[model samples]
Target: MTASLSQLSGRVWIYPGDPDPEAVMPCVAVVADDAGSTVVDAGQSPAHARLVQSALAEAGLPAARRLVYTHHHWDHTWGACAWEVEEIVGQESGATLLSAEARRSWSQEYLQEQVVANPRLGPSFKARARAMTGWADFAVRAPSRTFTDRLMLSGGIEVRHVGGKHAPDSTVVAVPGSGVLLLGDCFYPPPFHLREPGPAGEEIDLRQISALVAEGFDWYVDSHSPPWRPPVPE
Candidate 1:
């Protein structure tokens, strides 16, 4: 799937994720600043990352000086190496997961074995893996710095650890100046679609979300969806 850069108002731009079978690239956010661009998430592979870089270059946005992961999910963190940034930030838990995942093989046979072992993760896993034509240069790099609760970057962007049922390490990036919140799959349920009478899934915690919304953000960016304006409470 080809990703094109679209401005989400002000200093934010997004490469919306593709839902097609060819590539399930996760949406990547670029927050432009005079210093440098702060990327919310890296895409699935080096190729995907290059696509993002090309899009940014064409848009005349600042080069990505920092890469921040919303979580350690393969779709979000696998492009770390390609970003070539000195600072990669993630939650401590997510950093640990990425460190461990960095040691694993992305081979087709290995991925197939994983799918066979975990039926709940089969469909989407297979689809994402199949989308990739090659993995010769694929590498997973853990964050250079890990934060426990919150971290404030050079720009007005804030990253918070908002764990959800989807992933314990899930986090969201808030650009207060732009009123845009980049949600990294923190509102999704676990693998329940592939199973009948699936195991009870945990509820998505909404307290943090509500509080963040209360903080004056009007636009929300989900990993799989385009940016949207959620009605702000009066």
Candidate 2:
């Protein structure tokens, strides 16, 4: 099994997995520009966060003072507790979700139960949780900076609160300089399953996704899948 898969390019860095092979870990991104580096999203656990941090150091990118979130899912935000970042940015709705009580956001107990319930996730959970020191003192942090529409990062990357596809708080990180778009939890057929729909909750609308795909990108990175050219949205 692949322990971890990392890829680096002139524009972006992708650290796609955790130490464990079986866990459903989100792929984290780092976009580099003139000022410094911007972390696109946190990962599954503290260990994954460290892996991301190490990847940045290895790539010789500047220290990441800004950590951006694609959405407020457990796998994406849990690692926020691990990254020692100065500012966290996300959609206002995603920030609201994180501002909630840790349990309300995502309970460690609930996550443990989930790991135990799914045989596929068992090995990864054990490894990640152990690395996180028994998941002790699990915490969630609210984003220091929140945006309803679009926000620009150090590297000229734009993070937009483009929801209605997976979670209402879903976000898309697009780096025009690098020709990459990090679509968080973008379901293939456009899952349109939203949690707590509001201003950010818009329908996936396959046509729009197809349009974005057609716009062209050097790389499309997502949470669970390998980095590849995005197919015309079906």
Candidate 3:
């Protein structure tokens, strides 16, 4: 899959005036073979999923063999149902969190605040919210296999279920062969707004992510950015 999509230089695909201020979420799709591929972090809508699928097809790869959620955040995981995949994988913590009724309440409140604050989103936001109301009912499945520290996949693809930084169940995928690291929301670019205030009132761990970034890779793919070459510090 990487071989086919290797020509795709990762870039930020901006969706204007989306409900969430964190509207420009990043999604990564990797084609493993003719039979399958893996899509990392399905985006906010089915349309987004279709767009991803089309891109992969255009590159002569399957839509996805499996759908892997970087975390349980709505923006990142909402479009999983749209993809044709054999299995859906997420951090164990994400599965637990998604199953709890508390997640629905929290998500609803969060979306409400985002929509109200950004009236520019208009009817499309409300429609999306209404559609997402069923997310609580959506099957939030854990990885068929769980990992604590790090797990390596068939093709030297290493996924580390590092403990929470941005969201409690965040996982980072490292393709050692290609030197590509998909950090999900753990490493947000500038103007970050996903840092919600927690119970103890601490902001999300940007430093933890910075430390993660320091480990280094030739290509750094955020759930939000197109494949990017990490910058060298002065």
Candidate 4:
């Protein structure tokens, strides 16, 4: 399930999922330096987490020292506990949502309702819900660290916590040195799964993401897709 670090450019290692992309969600864990590694988002299950860990070890990078949740969705945040990291960072609002026990309970219940309403999700939805059962316990410890606007991590990696567009608390991790941007669920690739309905009449904030992409990035990393790709030139 763990792929080796083949194409090395600026010490970047990508771990692809074993199953087809449709069956398995993708995650990108980037190591800024020896001191810590910044995980873009947790995978769908513990097995994916293990694959990430194995890839990190194989690449000579440290295990996920800092876990970063792109959004507050279960698919992205459930497997976070597998890392057992000390510090989990995200946007202030997202961190707040995860911090409260009531909110966590409500979110899970809401997802369950959605599954029941749409039987297409069927057993898969229930399985995912079960996987997220322990979130109340894990999410409490998650996102111990929070940022408002932007924060600079070690190794010149800058993470900007952008809101008002995506999920009320979407954090985008940008590596200025490498020009790699980790965009969580904000502007996902094709075959996008709008798991939750958008607010009333507001559309996705493509402008914000476009502006960031315009700023200049060598690679673009999304939560639901494969490895980061080269960003279009401004």
Cα error, candidate 1, residue 130 (Å) = 1.7
Candidate 4 TM-score, C-alpha based: 0.74
Residues 89-122, model 4: lDDT tens digits: 7788887776673244434676688777977565
Instruction: State the C-alpha lDDT per candidate.
Output: 0.82, 0.70, 0.59, 0.64
Q: What's each prediction's clash count?
A: 0, 0, 7, 0
Clashes counted in candidate 2 amount to 0
lDDT of 2 by residue, 151-225 (tens): 776657788876765667888889877788888875433322322356445444576467667769877776777
lDDT of 1 by residue, 1-234 (tens): 666899987899998888763466789999998788999888887778899999999999999999999988878887777887869999999888888888888778888888888877777678657756678877789999899999998888899998877778999998878879898888877534433353445554567566666666768888887777878459
TM-score, predicted candidate 1 vs. hidden true structure: 0.89
The local lDDT score (0 to 100) that residue 93 gets in candidate 4 is 83
Q: Best candidate, lDDT-wise?
A: 1
After superposition, the stretches of candidate 3 with alpha carbons farther than 4 Å from their true spots are 1-24, 101-144, 188-206
TM-score winner:
1
Report per-prediction Cα RMSD to one decimal: 2.5, 5.9, 6.6, 4.7
TM-score of 3: 0.68
Local error of candidate 2 at residue 117 (angstroms): 13
Our model 2 lands, by Cα RMSD against the true structure, at: 5.9
TM-score of each: 0.89, 0.75, 0.68, 0.74
Which of the two, 3 or 4, has more lDDT? 4
Candidate 1 wrongly placed segments (more than 4 Å): 192-208, 232-234
